[model samples]
Target chain A: MSLKPTPVSRASPNRAGATLDAFLRWREASIIVVAILLTIYFQAVNENFLTSANLETVSQFIAASAIIACGEVMLLICGEIDLSVGQVFALAPFLMHFGTNAGLPIIVAILLALVACGLIGAINGFITVKLRVPSFVTTLGTLYILNGVTLTLSHGSPVETGGSEAMGNFLGASPYAEILWAFAAVAVMHYVLRQTRWGLHTIATGGNLIGAAEAGINVARIKIGNFVLTSVLGGLTGILEAHRIGSIDPLAGGTTVMFLAVAAGVIGGTPLAGGSGTIIGALVGAIVLGVLRDGFTLQGINAYTFDIIIGAAILLAMISNIHLGRLRRGGGR
Target chain B: MASALRADNIVKRFGSVTALDGVSMHVEPGEILGILGDNGAGKSTLMKILTGYQSPTSGTLQVHGQDVVLRSVDHARSLGIECVYQDLALVGGLSVAHNMFLNREKLRRFPPGMLDNGEMRRRARQVLEDIGVNIPSVDLEVERLSGGQRQAIAVARAVSSDARILLLDEPLAAMGAREAALIIDLVLRLKARGNLSIIMIMHNYGQTLDIADRIMLMQRGTVTYEKAAAETSVPELMDIVRREYRAVRSA
Candidate 1:
């Protein structure tokens, strides 16, 4: 009996076209192309745009947002969001500062701060999943509560974290230190999201909660775990930033950081609607924003213009992502 | 031959509404028991109870003649009861292999909870091929598949899990004739294996008569009739259904 050929044929002539098509269809491919083009344009406009020192500075600036984005990507994939991540980012550092002044060991202080963030994450998860409250509302309430507590505790002033000099050096002495943490978060998170059962469950939870539950997956656990993961990552980013910057600024990570991290994830092709996401995509998204901001600054563009350009870029990326997703479903050419 | 599954007087109630009223049924090893019911006939509720999606209000469930309490779908699965739901319970964003191994994923030795994707992919391909499913790749996401292929994948997933008793809820619903035929053929092939017992809930009497060894007709949360398939005819089942409908309309 003659067997019928499969729909996805692998003939040699079609293979070449298919390879190119696969590249074009990948969500990150367009973003990479845009980043490269932007780099070329920046190089033409300014001599210092491609300098190693300048690149290092860009990496330092992007690292915190990148770290937060890594967590946000996972949460978003599981069909939820944490608007309070920005507050956790600021609150964690202040908690650390208070811990150090209270005579706790530095590592102990950091752990306490992270624990606080984890508690907040648990609260968010409990309210959202158990109480059936919308996550957007739950996290918004958390954002205010955390912001209020941080402001009241620090009295809206920067706390001088008087730690050992070795601690400071170890935390953020090298320009690459914070960037290394960001990359480490990305690498670890990427592995968890792609190569683990936990990640698969997360995707399934977001894709179809009822379906996943019927399949014997613990949907609540997956969602709650993601919330905790995002908040802990946010707290860690705050600690690293505080150590690098030499002080815990009360108002350091406001809604701007939260928005930027969320935007990075969205720009990286992680759908806000959930079901699908990638950590590597978020990392590249952070770099794209970093390169844009750095290049525009080098070209003497006003800082205010950065907002307009970045906003437009996010919209464009979203449009392309939607189209690419449709193409993958064989909806349109 | 011993029975594979036995549901004794399964009763389900949601507040004042009674969904399944003392429904008792059984399927012998390798036999296909066809459940025939209309809307609100408690067909789905009974399936849910058997599959551990929901607990029966009051019932004794037996698998291989041993009484067991299924606390959850996972528990049911552990007891070798696997269900292919009408909606298919598939994650559209996940690849075919990933969806097949949804909660029962294989972990790598080194990473300790990491998915063994390569192994899963290989096994998924082999299982689908062994089952004679004509799919190009297991790497493709389920959303890209046609309705028939998607149904096939769901059945393949259930069967590959070593389920001794398979519960198919409206497997041929909303499917084209060819797709329905494909599923029927798959079901027959599984029956030929002789280790698996099948309980298929279907709407079509003729189709049910075509594949089932025994036929069960349910109406208003109760079984109205049960008979050997060879002893019952479609017109006889239709007359019984019409009588139930007339009684319901009068009530």
Candidate 2:
């Protein structure tokens, strides 16, 4: 489709304001505004919601999820999904913990974790692409294997994730400063997805893998790269959490955060079917959910109720975003 | 001129199904070959094997006098054998410039390992302009573009890759009259470039008659007839298609 849809009702190009207004009414921006307004309103209602301490806590909580979600967004955009993210996330940190405990330097441990996660991603991609297995099922299998590995290694107990004081210093200022890291990470990934050939291919793959391959996109590489991004983010999160909590729990680095990350992505307007959405929207979605969680907790909501609220919010975001996505695709049946 | 591509006795079977059996064809330099067949006539399978999307069980493929194994799509592309599948594979979420140069992005050094976007957008615009693909904006996502525009960009992108042989599978399948005409025009312009050999598989006989120098008919994984474009009529071609399909069904 070569033509950008201009409202046929208006003819004159002389009126810049009308065109600008139409542009501003883009669906992505509208949902983001709604998310922001809800956050601000809740913050107003509960003073604790606006406090530096809670914001710091939420920042740390959302940072890892946000990071993992970036990779998920890229993968999903290509019409593929990485269910192995939660597992790969755990796998990387586990590698670092086991390696670092045995005597490798912290930098080396972190590098190993990053590299291992990347390889795991590559393997997952290879299996999916080569075998022609649906990424969903392949990643799901990897997810189970990873989870089993984490459980077996940790014996269902926390692993001491210690080796580098320098690494600890690099991940935080009580985690809010971690937001700076998250922002920078998001920016870098955003640039990659938007500006680079790899980034374009990832989007293209998500949009139409057939078309992407025809256009010379190494769709498998894009998928592998995305898988690595998702896992690396999760591992980085694990690395950060290990540093933050001063220990790593197998279940603590689990699929719930991965689910939440994806939910935040969908809520932020990244379509589940792929080839749409932005890193910025995902970031905003992460923050919006973080704020919503904080606001509810400050209002003295019960823990179970909070889960119910989050689950509902995730469902709402999925339905609304999906419906809007359909409209954007010219209301497909 | 010598033939640019030759497929000799290509045989591909999927278990009980013989997708392409003893199929053969050749494309001389700068020739436009049209292939016609009904659904499941091995059009895609033969093309797939030729373009390295699939490997034939027994066959010889020669490009520029070298018998090459069509191993992977990337490998095929590297050899300057390009394929445009019927799906018109375009990522709907990307911008026109981005789509026009999806994998082959023009990257400029930003800072050390970083990249420059300003250059990529500029290159995209330049390519689109060169190919005469008119999009309202390079920044607008492809979903916003019309069907014709998308096809134009897809064709333009394929031709831009400096491909010596372009295999287009059903490029006009689902296009309206106006869209189809423009694409046909694009094909003629590409043919005029003189270094490119084109093999287009199409259902629309009229359009194929208009552009192709020669036509080949296949039925049930085998070539049944071949004729120069000027030598065949629509009714004759239709009879050949029907006759081939009947023979295959009875066999």
Candidate 3:
């Protein structure tokens, strides 16, 4: 009468099929299958798709988006979003540059830049939470403000990334460095979301704000902390990109990257409506997007056509995810 | 024994509008007290003050014979006061065990900040079992459960925290007869434990009489009537309410 599973599981005597059904019922399962199929198709389309060099190139694309998606997924699950994170991404390397100009060491400059980004996130959080402005509008305003600040500081010109070659390689110049950072971010965030109280509170905050508050979960702090995390991660991704390209462009990242990160999260099964999300699922989504971009580029698809196809792919993924989500919510009975 | 809770001449005002006006009530230890009222009768305001969701403009509250002013919901909980709201206060996306532990999660020592999910699940199961809640599994998200089950979980959470005073705001509202019966049984079970003092703000007359040991009726921000539930009938309550309605209309 208590603590037992529903009759559905007992009625099915085939254990293996039941296990497989459960696996498929997971939110990440569909995306993982999609990523695998894309990988095989790309490899078949072009021999170079699986080549180590080409794989590294594809990973570079996944790296930035996946890292940002990790933080965005957390924010989304908590019912907030940071549109200015991409702008913060464009701002970090320049802040680091100014730090070095002020006689700070490279590492110190990088840390300072990240700290500054965290402050920006706090501002975003305060304005959204305390001022009662919607987060989207708040971040949108910061997005423009950050962009203008970066452009004015750089005089609208690109600058060579100032750190030593060794530092550069450590950040993102090496083929695997950026991807490694992304993977690390994913692993730590996955643990946080699944194993820590902070993550559980974040989910609860999004699930039902009044309910979370009634339970004494400190909903505001959870939202503010996630905002800070998203900004810092965004800054880190920007710095990595600057080092990888050996130059910092005032226009790098901006809206395109933010949208891609958000798209990855949604495709990974984190709903825009909030309350639930999966970090590993975001990584798989990033992989799917990366495979499409790099694979099409390898097959010589034009950039314009690629955008159209990517747009269509995102739509298809979202529609399928919505249906799959029904199965998930049905408890797989 | 001292009453488990006592509110002395409580008054609450929202700007120029008075919500609760010089109302006083008390509930004996191990007793189920039902507060009945219509909409805008200050029932919610009084419940809010009791749960420390809001402060009274003028009043004194005594819990276990100790005079106190509750500062916030958490402060009230620290004094062993817990509320199961009409909304149930359960996260739809969270598992039953997760919702039960919520802010007070059990943590593993070695990992420093990681949740001790296994321990939480065990304790949640024990608590639910002890309270006689027939949850299918603690791992199921609360949204998957029926309204009665969700209400039961909310009560289980309150009891698990050792709440000496339990407040339920419209626990049976919008529920079917069977669902309401489930909660009624659960409430009776808690009362039978002989420790918790229960206060339910309700709109249903017959149901309140069936469950509460004593009942108080509120009208226009004041206590209009009070009596033992065993001595009150549905028609008697309806006549009183109708008289009050007529008086308001004539005035």
Candidate 4:
């Protein structure tokens, strides 16, 4: 006694297309379209937007940001946040600073940085998930502490990693390295969130923790893993920046990256209120932001003006993404 | 087959308020039991206790004729108990196949440590097909599905878990007319699965009578009346509910 949800499955071509269109989710479609449009605009304005040189830069920026944002997206989707990213970004390189000065191999230094950064994430997870502290407050406190540690380690001067050039080149400066890494990040996360049970559990954990627990997900463990991954990604971004700019500074990575990361996430159609978002959409959102910023930069615009523009664009994207009034691209029924 | 689930003399208190006082109920295998109550009748509280969301201060809970203790949701699920919350609790962003396999996803450990999507989609499609759920494609995301389809997917997801006892909280609360009929039919089909037992919490009397094999009327944290569906009419049920389940009218 079951009737088809849709009558006439093989009906008119137009109707079938409409039915399919109904299924393309709004946020994902909009983010991709926005990313593409921004790319086209930048390409038209300046021959630089799509050139191999600028393309490498885009890949590196996305590689760094995507690594951090992917974790944030998972955390946000699971109803958590990490405000300590900038600090984690700064602190990880110091692990290299100390490890190298102490006569360790560059590989050991990088591993130390990853572990130290991961520990910071673990503490955040403990306070927020285990101790029942709000993530907003807990991570904010961690931001200060990590910043302090990095500053204390740096002693208010820049330390250039001249000898560790090989390590830096392998992870940060290698041409097209960012593209491979970005592709790997998106592909793996897409697979995890879509193909693996852990990915589903992560989404469910963020969507409705209570419901997920009832459904048999280890919510605490998932949140902990998300927090740790986010921190590690931020650390890697810091290391990449240190190599690209040729020095490490506690004050260099600004507060703008955090806001930018959060904005890309929401614009990707991942809600601030969590439960459902896609990794591909996240990459699209980041590209949109990067293109917007780079496009304005190529036009000889001031850096600060681009911030105002980005703020406005992000607000608009959020409004459109949040309001589900019309048919949007990348949807499904 | 004595009963799929049985709660005896369940008593729960919430810091000076008695949410469930001497509450007890049973759902025999192959029967659909509808729970009716007015506001503050402790309907939710009783269900929570049975589903292991909350522990009853004083009560004995049994599953499939064995004395059981439910310390957490896993404990309940291991005993074949599953709850379909009013929220439907499905992630809207993920695909139908992804959501269907959520919390019970298959792990693929080949080709350099990544989630295996092909297997996940295959399994999700099989679950949907086994539950008689047909759509344009199982690979489509859940956010695009209609409210009725989402709800059906949820119920199908629940029963697909090898659960013998299903607790559906306000399954028809927000559904429109056409949608409500579809859900009732789905529930009836589930009842025909003899090894399964269901406890449906609803406000719609017509739909309750249409699907439930027995009815339990609850009021002010207590069960006032219990009768087979064949022995009761809407008006007869209404009168007892009006007089005994005063909380509904007052609230």
Candidate with top TM-score is 3
Ranking of candidates on DockQ, top first: 3, 1, 2, 4
Assess each prediction's global lDDT (C-alpha) against the native: 0.89, 0.77, 0.92, 0.78
- Model 1, which residues run further than 4 Å from truth? A1-19, A331-333
- Give the DockQ of candidate 3: 0.60
Backbone Cα, N, C clashes tallied per candidate: 0, 12, 0, 12
lDDT of 1 by residue, B1-251 (tens): 55799999999999999999999999999899999999999999999999999999998999999999889998899889999999899999998999999998888898688899999999998888877887767888888787888888999999998899999999989988877888898889889988899999999999999999999999989998999999999999999989988997899
Taking the tens digit of each residue's C-alpha lDDT, what string does model 3 give over B59-123?
99999999999998999999999998888789998999999998889999978999999999999
Residue A202 in model 2: lDDT: 72
Evaluating just chain A, the predictions reach TM-scores of 0.94, 0.88, 0.96, 0.89
Taking the candidates in order, what DockQ does each have?
A: 0.56, 0.45, 0.60, 0.37
lDDT of 2 by residue, A1-333 (tens): 233344423333566865554544465665577667977898788867767777788888778778877888887787777877777666666788778777888778888988888888887888888888898899889889989988898788877766556667676535565677788889988887765666777777777877777666677777777777777787777777667777777877677778878877877778887777678778878877787777777888867887888888778877877676555455211
Q: Higher TM-score: candidate 2 or 3?
A: 3
Q: Which CAPRI level is candidate 3?
A: medium
In candidate 3, the residue pairs with backbone N, CA or C atoms under 3 Å apart (3 or more residues apart, or in different chains) clash, namely none
**Across residues A66-111, which tens digit of lDDT does each residue of candidate 3 receive?**
9999999999999999899999999999999899889999999999
**Candidate 2 chain A, poorest ten consecutive residues by summed lDDT:** A1-10
TM-score of chain A, predicted model 4, versus the true chain A, to 2 decimals: 0.89
Q: In candidate 1, residue A176 scores what lDDT?
A: 84
Which portions of model 2 show Cα errors greater than 4 Å?
A1-28, A87-97, A114-116, A119-123, A131-148, A159-167, A173-177, A323-333, B64-71, B112-133, B193-195, B245-251
